[model samples]
Target: MAETTLYDRGMATRRSVLGDAHVDNASAKMTEFDADFQQFITEGAWGSVWSRPGLTKRERSMITLALLAALGHDEEVAMHVRATANTGATPDDIKEALLHVAVYAGVPAANRAFKIAREELAKREGNGQ
Candidate 1:
């Protein structure tokens, strides 16, 4: 089978997972300062891996949270936790993922992730969005 076009597949998956506003903001921020990095994530992460059908977005989101938490990627972890609302990953799901992270990735990582998740979830809960 022929490979899917990167732009078509990547843009669709990006919008589906990240939401329009977040994607638009990221796009707007992609200037000469980080154009290459932006393109790399769009083509590699969104297009290549996320476009695969092996797992659902919910599954992917959970894995992402765990990996981000493990890697001490606080900013990305916060972003993914916020995205849980759009990705159908409930607060309970995040809790479970952090529990796993605590055991495997270390308690410190999970503890920090929990704080971030709690704050972000609260914001989302208040807005009812």
Candidate 2:
């Protein structure tokens, strides 16, 4: 038997947190133009970083949300917000994280993040989740 590679481990962790459906959708849409970028994120972000033992997925989710929001990565913030379902992050936790973003990263960033987070949460609830 062969030992698992970072890509394999990353795919597993990504699927667990982002869900098979989302991961499948991403995989299906991968083109040559973005294939390398996709692999990099899987092996580097998901495999090496997210798969670490330092923090629970829930804590990582919160930190990810805040950082994404602070950086104005609106789409990623929304995606990670949806990922809260798998990460065990609550709505209140999201709110608190946004508050921290407001204080440290600025109210404008947090304000936009709050709107994005609300939309994502509403979309999830609307889907019968």
Candidate 3:
């Protein structure tokens, strides 16, 4: 068997957290224009950082949610919220993170994130995810 590379490990971690369908859809839409950016996130974000053993994926997921919320990355926040099903971060975990975001990043940023998170949670609950 081939020795696993960073890209391979990243892909596995990405699929585990984000789900195969999302990964496959994103891969299917890949073109030369954004290929390097996609590879960078996989190798750096998923492989280098997320695959590290220091933090549970749940912790990482909450942290990601908080940062994304703080930065007002609404779509990314929603995506990550949906990913919590696999990461073991519950809705309460998301709430706590966003509450932290409110305290640190400001209420407006976290307020918008709360709306997005609630919508995503409802959708996830409906889907039984």
Candidate 4:
């Protein structure tokens, strides 16, 4: 059998975690200028780190949400919040993580994250997720 490449592994992991529609949209919109950047994240972030067995996907999802919130990445925070559907990170789990973020990363960041998460969660529920 042929050895799986990082790109292949990354694509699979990313699609599983983020969902096929989102991945497909991102892939379809890739521009020549950003192609290398996308490939790098696929290989490094999704393939190398996310594929690690040390942490469960749920654990990683919590960490990712906290980090994104702490960094004031509102959009990414929402995106990952949606990803929780596949990662098994519950809304309560996210709330707990954001509580920690409030202490370590500032209340404002955590507050905004909570709002974004709420919006996404509502949408997910509305869709019968």
Instruction: Provide TM-scores for the models.
Output: 0.93, 0.96, 0.97, 0.98
Writing each residue's lDDT as its tens digit, candidate 4 over 1-129 gives 998999999999999999999999999999999999999999999999999899999999999999999999999999999999999999999999999999999999999999999999999999998
Candidate structures ordered by TM-score, highest first: 4, 3, 2, 1
Cα lDDT tens digits for candidate 3, 10-103: 9999999999999999999999999999999999999999999989999999999999999999989999999999999999999999999999
What TM-score should be assigned to candidate 3? 0.97
Number of the top lDDT candidate: 4
Reference-based TM-score, model 2: 0.96
Q: Candidate 1 or 2, higher lDDT?
A: 2
Q: Write the per-residue lDDT of candidate 2 for residues 23-69, one digit (tens) a residue.
A: 99999999999999999999999999999998999999999999999
lDDT of 1 by residue, 32-123 (tens): 98998888888899998988998989999999999999999999998998888778998999999999999999999999999999999999
Clash list (residue pairs), candidate 3: none
Model 3, position 71: C-alpha lDDT score: 93
lDDT of 1: 0.90
Reference-based lDDT, residue 7, model 3: 93
Q: Please say which candidate is ahead in lDDT: 3 or 4.
A: 4
**Worst 10-residue stretch by lDDT in candidate 2?**
1-10
Which stretches of model 2 miss by more than 4 angstroms?
none
lDDT, model 3:
0.96
Which of 2 and 3 is the better model by TM-score?
Answer: 3
